[model samples]
Target: MSYRAVLRTPHALRTFLAALVGRLSYGVVFVSLTVAITVATGSYAVAGGAIALFGLGGVLVAPLRAGLVDRYGPRRVLPPLAVTYAGLLAGLAATTWRPGTPGWVLIVLAAVAGAAAPPLGPVMRAMWSQLLPDEAGRQRAFALDTVVEELLFVTGPLVAGLCIAAGAPAAGVALAAALVLTGTLAMVSSPVARAWPRVEAGAVVAVRVNRARLEPVLVASGLGLGLGALGLLIVAFATERDQTAAVAWIEAALAAGSAVGGIAYGARTWAASQRTQLALLVVALAGVLAVAGLAPGVAALAAAAALAGLFVAPTLTIAYLLADRSVPAAARTRAGTWVNTAFNAGSSGGSAAVGLLISRAPLPVCFAAAAIPLLLSAVLPALHERVDQQVEADPGAEHDDDRLEHLAGEAAG
Candidate 1:
């Protein structure tokens, strides 16, 4: 769990870097494609529709794709999809560049592009279980995963800005596709990936391990409410201020705060169960997000945003950790996908809901809307207590009740 261990372990380092590069590319691709399409058509609505289809493709099939990885291993599943996705992306860029290519045609290409893209998060997360058996080690790794994702979003937009400024926004998409392909190939080629265990029925799939892991997945979905709301608020607040450009940096500051928080959280150990920490962090998030709505101006919102983001990474890390431990190895990838699916669905739905509300109410209403999930998150103390009961029973779990108590009375009793 130490920094040196994560940094020094060859397999850990390799998995971490591969996931990082692939995610960075994914972060850049969507925005860059939107920019290219918007510039070409002079219609943000058209671009939005296309991007929505792209995201929908992934959301719809993520579990199925992840299941394939679980059943067949990453080596069998990732390479061909990566190659096909790369080709599709390149084709989409080229098609968009053609003079007067039909919008419908571009939309179809986008769907294919999304469908072909590798399920990077699920695969990498599944690998962590095989590579790191220590609970503390996995916790640190998941925290690092959150940090990498935050940094990727922060950097992705910057890269898109550069590509757009260069008068070839498609370059950003192509660049991202290239990075993902290269990184995925490298990851699969690694020794750990090649040796990844395939699930054989009745081998190690325990009944307890197969129990539903839906709680953390649901909380993760709830956690995305703020992020989705923030997406709309970016446009709403920026337009209201007549400095629409400032939204990017404001959001970047928030992501930066998240990344820093994740690093800090991982560097130290806490004497609390994952479930307890998640509940506390989520309640804290609710408070921070609500306070953000009352900020006097954009500058104030920036500070509030950063403060609000402080709990995000740690909360998400705990959710992933819970998912990893809750499922058998054969089902880990699929379980991880449930978390991803819920998170994306929440972000999209939350943004749309808040966007509609903004039209009928004050801007603060939008900010308040984002905090709704946090309220739901705050209600998870019961679930925390239940999960703690399970953990305390697990022989491998760190059961130091003297230092870390579940929120309720003895869960077993």
Candidate 2:
């Protein structure tokens, strides 16, 4: 596979592995914080709110953080942030561990830690374009990244679960903190990472990109992710009846499906446009997830979840691929951050909105509510494809107008 060649590149393996470890926290911190807080306070409400604040921290920081990575590069920007990120995680652990700590303290600490979230994913993904510029190689690299992300999604909760079981939820949080610190240091020190320019000086450079062409796919994919978040909430509701044991299995199944899909999708390139594939997969997910809410047992729910997950990694890979291909190198970091921030906002909003609805509505209704966004997601791509086709069809129209103008000039002469 081209991926093998990609890894053979200088410093590729080291950078990729470090990135995998660091980005694992993408899924871990939320699980660790939520579980640990719930265990301490015996309140899911507080746990949920705390986790949301953490995400909000990232959302608030993404644009600025991305710009820094772009201007100064990861080596210069990440090391300090890595130290700060680990410190914040440690602080959160310490603050939340106290028995009588005010709830507000935990919330504030979570936000601060989240704002300090590492930029490993963005930097690493950006590096892939530089590392493997070919279409095949780049797609394979993205697929590998997506698969690792799926593993993180599955393993995050499992690791946290084991830590919580062995000690308390704080153990999980502490472990995650250590991973971030270790992984961040490793990533920044990698040869490729260190080789990146420290910073570009003089007036700040900004590149104007034509988003008119890319917006539809971006919106469609973003909404698809948001709907995926809605499905996650439905799964939460499915497990609400104290089916704690089943929750892990269901989540595992979902993660597994995404991993499998990514591997399979990356095995061969298809002729279809990325937008077409993205739209189709997301539309398919809408139906599967709506039915998933009606699953009669844990086993059934697990199967449904897996089916819903089948589309996730591929969709994300395409979205990431599009982001890389669409934006100029100068805007790479900002573009990556834009995609992430948008997706996070969508996912968090979906979960928050569904969390509110879950208490009052039937599980099926909540699941169906999630599907509504997916359906809307389908519309964006469809329109995008039509626009693309129209553009293709009228390619010569402008040239013809130019020809007419030339003839008019000749006649005037």
Candidate 3:
């Protein structure tokens, strides 16, 4: 095999390790911060409001920030961001005992912290494409990346719960922040991260509102909302059965299933077309809906939930890969921001919807409700592919479908 081939072969392992380090530290800190803020405020609503502020900052700035990554490269931007984030987290820790610290101050700190949120996930995805430099290698790299993200969250909350129980939530957050800074800095300095392509001057950049890049992003965002809803359902389902403590197990099973699916999909030599991936997504959605009908016990529900989650990481990884191939390098970060923003937005909506649904309807219905968007997402791939073909075949056919075609092409290169 050529040098590039060998390099790509090892990339999956390297990316997973690096991402694992980043995820463990950051995820733990995030959970700890949430717990700390909630305890200090003595109000779940206030805590949630604080979190909402952070999400808002992330959503508002993600596109602009992503553009910076595209301009400066991940290596250059990530280190400073990580360091600053750690410093801010430490500052929050220092002020944990100050009586009557205004809520708005906390909100501002949270927003700033969130705005500077680590670029590991997006930057790493971009690096995978660059490091692997082939369609197949890139695909596998994304698959593992998705799995790590899902898995890390499973550990993050458990660790945070322990720290909170021990009356040291701030310590946990500080530790998480320090580890994140250390891990990101270490990874960026490593040969793997440094091997990524440098940003060239005068690359064909496109940041203005382009319909071609917006539609699929919206769809991906919708998918995020659906996943968020699924999470809420899991929590509610467990709560309904008075197995609230088992929430961790539910999340773990879901993450495990997702990791397994991603590994299996990535290792396979026989690649599916984008269309096939979409079809499988539909199957996965069907499975999710089927979970609602499963027997109601922690074990059975967990098993069904895991099977349902098996499709999630792979599905998301494919979407990221498609967006990478479809968007221009100049617009890649913005495109990524669109997806991330969609996820955050969807998460907020899904959580709310699921909470309301659980109160008003059956638990199974909650699961089935989330499936609707998956079915829509499934249709998007074929429809997008057809639109892409049309745009390629006749570039000048000025039709709305042509606009949709342009968007599809932008999303699925």
Candidate 4:
């Protein structure tokens, strides 16, 4: 299916556009908050702490927020979360309006705002599963979504930069508040979102963490870890050569590669199962990253980075698709959220891990180390496929495995 077909899916354009508007706030808020807090308190340390707390708040509660949506539907849950999140952003803007605002106040407001932030991305992915029931259409939609989200992150910082240049850092925060609030309200107003059925309060089913489900999270986490380390490693590489300006161009190349790769992956149908595809993609990404560390110059490194990035979006899109397929419709949102949460957590951990390694080890060794996670993670899906093949070869074994899974689910519940 073409991208146009995905857009033409009934109500897809309106709902997706609205979600994009709200998701854009995510790209804007972090930069705005960091700059605003720094300007208010005149301390990068405090600004950094506030951003950390904000991220922690969001990550910690993401599953719970998604679970709420699973039970109550978006129309009933999204508005309140959006309103509270926007209100906190506005409050944060007010506090950061003038110099000498207490650092503690800014930190507290940011954390609360993040905690209240709506899970528009996860919810929208769930909606896509509903709107595009066909696998081909769903693949195209997810690719389009991932690519646009990448663009939003790139654009968001520029918007914040503009606000900063205008000498109104807090205005960026206020703008983010308006965007999310308005966009979420408009999204939920759509017939698809409004008609989303709510699960009964006690109707939640236990989703077993089998190989099918766990493999996606593992791969996603590994991919995030490798990419996260690559970001800082590239900067370090450039700094060592006194070519720091090249860092932006290298990062831009990576983004460009991902966008191109996503469009290409979605535009065609593949014969490989999602599992095999994910495993191969991760292996390719790992190999490219390892080779990137061997590049002798900034230009060569940028080319390798672009090559490594070609698999990034497709890997993530497949991970989400795996997650969506692992659970029933009612639990898909939470499942996808878990994959996302794993990726973000892995990214943060990767950055910290690489920071320590980069200082103590050779640059090439550090790059190889960064690729370790991806290499190890690629084993999971391959192993899962082997086990599935074994089960297929033995009918009694398959039956027993199903029974075991059922019992596990029961125990989990």
- RMSD values for the candidates in order, in angstroms, are 4.7, 6.3, 4.4, 3.8
Stretches off by above 4 angstroms in model 2 are 38-48, 197-199, 207-233, 236-244, 294-297, 359-362, 398-413
Model 1 weakest 10-residue run by lDDT? 203-212
Ten consecutive residues with minimal summed lDDT in candidate 2? 399-408
Top lDDT prediction, candidate number: 4
The runs of at least 3 residues in candidate 3 whose Cα sits more than 4 Å from the true structure, single-residue gaps closed, are: 1-16, 97-100, 191-204, 207-216, 290-294, 386-413
Instruction: Write the residue-wise lDDT of candidate 4 on 1-413 in tens digits.
Output: 89998999889999999999999999999899999999999999999999999999999999899988888899988999999999999999999999877888888888888898999988899999999888999899888888888889888988999999999999999999999999999999988887675676678767887777888899989988998999999999999999999999999899999998988998999998888999999999999998788899999998998887789989989999989988988887899899898999899999999999998999999999999999999877876665566677876665644644654566458
Clashes of each: 0, 0, 3, 0
Better of 3 and 4 by lDDT: 4
User: Could you tell me every candidate's TM-score relative to the true structure?
Assistant: 0.89, 0.86, 0.85, 0.95
Candidate 1 lDDT over residue span 199-269, tens digit each: 77545343342223766777888888778888788778878989788887788778878888898888888
**Of candidates 3 and 1, the better by lDDT:** 1
In model 2, state the lDDT of residue 371. 78
lDDT for residue 69 in candidate 2, whole number 0-100: 84
**Residue pair clashes in candidate 1:** none
